[model samples]
Target: MQLMHKGSALVTDQDIGENPSVIEHAKRMGLRLITFGPHCNAQVREMGFHNGNLQIGMGSLRLGISLQSDGHHMALNAQAALAALHALGYAPAQVQASLAHWQPMIGAGQPQLLPSGICLLDHSLSNHLLSMTAAFSQLQSVAPHVSRRLIVLAGIQPGQASIDAAQLALEPLVRDAQARRVLLYGEPLRPLAAALGDLLHVNWYDDLNQLICSLLRTTHKGDTVLLAGRATTNLALAADAIRDSFSGHGGHLIASIQAPCFDPHQKQMNMHS
Candidate 1:
């Protein structure tokens, strides 16, 4: 199954959470620095393309040339991006992670105007899909339709920024998705069940029992659903959900992709190490 989350490049084949070559690729991409919050930590604040913590938290920032985020700390490890920017011979741009604590940065008041290779801004991790939906909407207009969307989460508390981002991202898709195409995330919503009910129509399931019930009611094969974002890996439970309900009706689970970088060949191959 294809991975569906964003910023998979930051995570590596080893799963140790650090990719030595990440920065090298970032540099080749001509990455500068992009700040999200204000000048919080000097080291992190003015760093290069590598980064995160937008939501409490981040899914990372969607730059004018590349990027997309409202957050789930999608790409926090910045060393790779840093190396990349430097290698490109570009003085990384500056990003403002928290403007609420803003100060004179890169010798400029507005980050967008900072002529450095990097740019910074305190993104509103206040909404999940705000970045992704916007990016997807734009991509749909330019690229071929993949019928797949990604969900990237973070290691933050619900109160941090995940809630805001989730509401911003998932709700609209759920509301707009055509019937069987909607794929409710497999992980439990924790204390979020009430919020889940707000989205309209489409089959919504919290677990296998609900998934089967929804299918028994209406669904079909060739239809698509996305299991996006970060959560405790629950493949067994997800398998159970599908297995317990596989027998009912006209539909079949065609794809169960999790998260793949937007352009893995391009994104991952950037590793210089």
Candidate 2:
């Protein structure tokens, strides 16, 4: 609201509840409102994506913009950018062409290939479940050759009303990713680790440094690591630690550890001590 001025345009998606309120507020302030999404009534609408490209159909005008990043969320974010551009009176063709050069910054689902051949998807900047799901989807698309996928979850806020419901919601995401082992860090995620229980191989960690070092020492080549957390958790530090490990002596140390991180007979590794 602070960003808006007289004759300015408000651009947003249909999912935001602030839309109607913002529209009324815009009208009072003489601000133009523009919305774009799957089910929004606006000048720009009909937005969707396939593979890594975003498609927007505004009436008879169609624009297909290639995304430099991964996931469904990126497509929506790009569509919102396009809508914002539309509100700003930019040509659709110009916006489409310009967006081709856009790339996601670190910690926003950007895939990083360490020198040790571990593909790390750092999504620690975000805490939402939807974003985590998108990160898993990204893994399926980008690292098909990954022999083992290890999830280094800083935390997860399920937002569900009950433990069973939250477990039901989270179970499939882990299973679908085919994660060989799950390493969870921080106190906020104890319920998350508990929810997974014995159904999936899960390890709980209180010491962030230990978790980082353990994964570094155990994970091998052809392994993909998905790091998910929020800013408050300082999960980005963990991502950095993993990246730094490979560039230094830690890389040599990982090569010497056993091939797989988990024992075939063990379902969970408790590192609370």
Candidate 3:
């Protein structure tokens, strides 16, 4: 909060505006403030989710902006982004057009479509328990028509506090997502096997290769896999492995994992299969 000097503005959500600390800080810093949400009085407001997208509008006007993303939380993020652009003096039409093709960056809800017809939602970049739960909710909301739902979690924290939270939250989230299987890597998350043992089929892996091998063998057409955790390198390799596995038979599976290279000329990240 201290970093925000006078004349600098904070664009946030209505829910966050109610924080006493934030209110006090803004008052102290003489910070310009913009808040967005579904609240009737918010500067930017949202309508209900429809057809896998979010609709938002400025104040009480009809929702004129459509965001190509799922989840109510994501709608708030879109509103905040729009509010920031508004603060920067971008015209509403310009901002709307720019956001039309917006997609989440790699490891942040980016959906990778594989040749084998699997849609992998990568959320490994920010894989705290809260984010993991939100990922499941988003998947449930957006891709309910998918044939199979698989969840891969890597590098769960082994601390008792984390495990306890997982114990309370993991099973319900997985059930709500209607996931067919839960594949867990890293020894830290092995304890989750017991918690989810009866309601769902859980697999634990100590080796990344083994997990990749199993994933390749088991997942079929029209499946959606949600990948989330701390081992980002391992997660990227796994996603690439899945993509390359369907490219050819034997030799291609051994191909080196390709990093998501940014191609400035194309103005998008290029994924090599």
Candidate 4:
């Protein structure tokens, strides 16, 4: 890609691996390059939950990046944009100030509190592991004092690889969150259930109705529920069922839907893909 200005470029290590030639090309073109990863300049200095949002402290800012789950990738994108802006004669403070009004799009870690004091982490819209992990961590941090934690995992696609990926992604949460119970819907859960065995209170269901029934029956007040996974087909139905199931209950619901991006030039938001 040709640059209009000789600006600095920030590329994550993962991105570099995916497009090393592009990085090399950019470097050769005289762009100052900054790489971020486990050992790089884009270290997440500090991370915590504040006012029901995730706050990441980096660089010189004591009150660092504060955003919702939807802003996870956008945070990194913002960093790159900041680098470009700084190279184009904008002050660091000016760039930061411009982002003050930015907000997370829908389905990007949007939390909804139900009537029963139950909080829902709705990440059902997308199934990217990194974003899901960030959302889970944010919820875990914010609701540490909740009475119980529940996970409603959608069924993965039919394949050993899909099952394996789901297992790997969920193992940490199951162990760390100390989840009181888990309601898994779909065929991909069989192996996972077998693997978890007695370690977790897992309830597997092939039918969506049964799964929702069990979820409603088991959930109680002061509990946190995380609804996630890659159920591409029945996501909308499941969301509606859950909403109706918890209608009178005094709990909270956080439905993660794909939110639109705001186009500053157009002064409007673009639809989620």
Q: Model 3 Cα displacement at 175 (Å)?
A: 4.4
Best by TM-score: 3
Tens-digit per-residue lDDT, 129-163, candidate 2: 67778888877776675457888877555565553
Which tens-of-lDDT digit does each residue in 83-137 have in candidate 4?
4554455665675655545655544456667776777667676566666676668
Error of 1 at 26 (Å): 18
1-273 per-residue lDDT for model 3 (tens digits): 688668887888888876788888899999877888887656777766665466676744554555665555666777788888877877666777666677666677766677667787877775466777778776775568634788877744434575546544566666666577777776555556556656536676666666676677677778888887775437766766666676455345553322212222322111111
Model 4 CA deviation exceeding 4 Å by range? 1-24, 30-74, 84-98, 155-169, 231-233, 243-273
Give the distance in Å from residue 223's predicted Cα in candidate 3 to where it truly belongs: 1.6
Q: Number of clashing residue pairs in every model?
A: 44, 0, 0, 17
Give per-residue lDDT, candidate 3, residue 6: 88
**TM-scores, each model vs. reference:** 0.29, 0.74, 0.77, 0.62
Q: On lDDT, who's better, 1 or 2?
A: 2
| Reference-based TM-score, model 1 | 0.29
Alpha carbon lDDT at 225, candidate 2? 85
How many clashing pairs in candidate 4? 17
Error of 3 at 43 (Å): 0.9
